[model samples]
Target: MMDVPSIKDFQWKTLAPLPSRRVYCSLVEAGGQVYAIGGCDDNGVPMDCFEVYSPEANQWNSLPPMPTARAGVAVATLGKRIMVIGGVGANQTPLKIVEMYNIDEGKWKKRNSLREASMGISVTAKDYRIYAAGGMGGDLRPHNYMQHYDMLKDIWVSLATMPTPRYAATSFLRGTKIYVLGGRQSKYAVNAFEVFDIETRSWTKFPNIPSKRAFSSFVCAENNIFSLGGLRQGRLYRQPKFMKNVDVFDIEQGGWMKIERSFFLKKRRADFISGYLKGRIVVAGGLGNQPTVLESAEAFHPGKNKWESLPPMPTPRCACSNIVVKNCLLAVGGVNQGLSDAVEALCVSDS
Candidate 1:
């Protein structure tokens, strides 16, 4: 049997930060560049701008704005193209539009729309196909439906639905399989975990997470899936509050384990967007209570299983998306006091 390593030896460092602030944006790596798409600002206004980061230059450049301004969207990359999926707009309305951006051609094109409108959806790309998992939809409510998009054919088809409906969950692609972690439903948070088999066209329940959470970051590294810090229910200042805790799941063994370590940032409820770059997990911004937006960033090393602080972003944000392009991590638009058009780039090598 393959050996499982302990999470003690991991090391991490932060690079630079993005220029703009946003939330619920899309992040993807294409043509050796990282792209950040539409999201809402701190005041809850939706944005239409998008940007890209080139690792070779260690800088960010503006791109054509999204045809529609929205947040809580999903993004995936196939070859040199990036796909932006459904999300919520400033009116708090769900969207089903799907758009494609070609890095090589520097252009945007509309593609097949989703069967159902969804926001805060978990999306991943495997074998050139993009899978859209459980999210909020249908009159701006959460749903258990799952959708699949074929980039080669430019088509979308409905698939097996999730056992429990959720939003703000994170999805990761390992081999031919897709794994989804915890998120919130209408009534409460969920510890439920599920996996979708691309070849079987079906869904199966995995072991429940040790803790229930929503808006947390999820990533796969060294054959293991890690669940980062998120809000847990608690009473705060004579009111309910969200707790911050980190956990992990061993996909090969099918079990969950919590990481007992102190966080550099304060505990707050916010969506986490992450990417695996250079054998490290890069976590960008998130939202807390009054501030609602965060500017700090961190990295986790699977080899050590620990967190390390990095440079703070110029613009604080939550519900944003990030993806690795070449060696840099690109953070896209998100809410920072208001819907923002800000974008940032970070390089671990600089640290």
Candidate 2:
């Protein structure tokens, strides 16, 4: 029999931060550029601004702001265009408005609104379609809504609703299957995981996470799913309350395992951004219960099951979104004190 090596064998490096600070925003890659869109500030003020980062230049440039400012929106890319979906605004109102940005034209256009307003949802694009799932709606209630947007038709249609209603969950696609993991219900954090088969138009439950959690970030890399840091029960802002544990699930095996290596992040995170890069899972800024926001970054190598530190973002934030474009990771607006205008970049090394 062969033996597996420990996670400590991997290496990592830090990169420059974004130009501004933001939280709860959406990020997507289009036309080889990373776009960061709407999110809130530390004070919970929502924003409408957007920005883009070019890995070749290692710089950020401003873009047309969203027609309506919002936080917790979901952003996905369809060819050279980007779609921004449901979220909440400064008034704490849920929104159903959907917008699209044309990278070549540098203009924004309105699209069909979502069936319902929601915030703290996750979105992914696959096979010319965008899937949005599980978020809180108006009245601050979580919903099980599962919807899809067709890029070619610029329309939306509802699919099967999630079995469990949740908020602040993460969603991604692996092959033809879409998966949603970890978030909060009305009562407590949930570790529930579900998968949707686009071809069959059905939903199925997978093995639940070992621990219940919310505001955690998830990424799919090399056919594996990784769930990272978020808050656990305890006094607000207290130390040892944040979780550094990393959980991995194998879609082929239908099994889950916890990575023994420690993330070594300074704090536990919630409402952070994460994405797959260069065969690794990269995580960015988020907030802790001290209720403090963080700017640090980390990379996890699934093959090694270990975490390595990366360059900290210029602006510390929480509730933000991250996207990969041409080997670069773009972090968009998130909460700092109020809704932020920050846009940062992480240049993934070729090595």
Candidate 3:
């Protein structure tokens, strides 16, 4: 893979902000258009507001709101339809309701709800099938249930349960296997790394993450899975400690790589935006040890084995709903003193 270019190759564009402030929203790109789905308002009440952004016009348009108001909904795009799954509803309760919005139809359709009401569920879709993994149920417990939605049958079919019961886990689909790693069981972080084979309908446990952290991000870059910065916790420390550690799992080698401290992020952050961009591992915006939210952005060059500083986010904020569309990484509504309507994109130049 080619090494990422310098900061000169990157540019941040401020786009039209959301119609209203929102946090915990879900953003998904379909047919080149970005959709910002349900999230909480400034009052922290769940909302059903739905909006779409057109890159060509650089504007946002309102769409039919979801039937159920929620936040932290798991979303996946299937063709032109966007699936909105379980999340926290009114009174801060977990919901099992599932809804779908068809861009062509311009309306919302109710689908099969989950067997259990839960929040923070992780969802992944491929080959006309949607696989929903771990979630925190209404009883305030994490569930290991694995269910897939069958479009033809219009029902949710239960699959083999994941060995680890945790919420907000990171899942990656490569070929026919879905790699599940690092989630939370209540407030504690889980280091479980597991993969499930679709055809075989079974799971294989892999090596646990070298570091146990809360709010860490896991991204797949080429053949390696990068576990980026997060907050480390222990009784030894007065409070949760922010980490700058980077651990990589080589798929072919079937084990973790010995990365030096120089390969880690320059800033210690958690709950940040991270992805593989143009052969570089990119990270931006999150809560750090600082007194305020982080705006610092950095990219790691695998070839040089060094981290390079990039242009900082114009509106530094945390807990933003983020998605990568084409070559741009969009950071949607997030907290900045209050709920923010900032919609910004970090675009990489082809040159």
My TM-score estimates for the predictions, one after another, are 0.78, 0.80, 0.98
lDDT (tens digit, per residue) of candidate 1 on 1-351: 323222233223333345566656666666666676776666668888788766667577888888888876788888888888888876778888888888778898999888777777888887788888888876646788787887778888888888878886767666677787777776467888888888897888998887665556667777677766666554344443444566667667777754556532334445655767667766767866663677666776454555665667666666555666555555555565555555565654523
Best of the candidates, TM-score:
3
CA lDDT, candidate 2, residue 300: 66
Report the error of model 2 at residue 174, Å: 1.4
TM-score of 3: 0.98
Q: What does the lDDT come to for candidate 2?
A: 0.73
The digit string of per-residue lDDT tens for model 3 on 174-262 reads 99999999999988999999998888989899999999998899989888999999999765557778999999999999999998888
> lDDT score of model 3?
0.91
What tens-digit string does per-residue lDDT give for candidate 2 at 248-278? 7877788886445553344577777777766
Candidate 2 Cα deviation (angstroms), residue 273: 4.7
Stretches off by above 4 angstroms in model 2 are 1-21, 41-43, 235-240, 258-273, 282-305, 308-320, 331-348
Worst ten-residue run, lDDT, model 2?
1-10
Q: Give the poorly placed runs of model 3, Cα more than 4 Å off.
A: 1-3, 234-238
Better of 1 and 2 by lDDT: 2
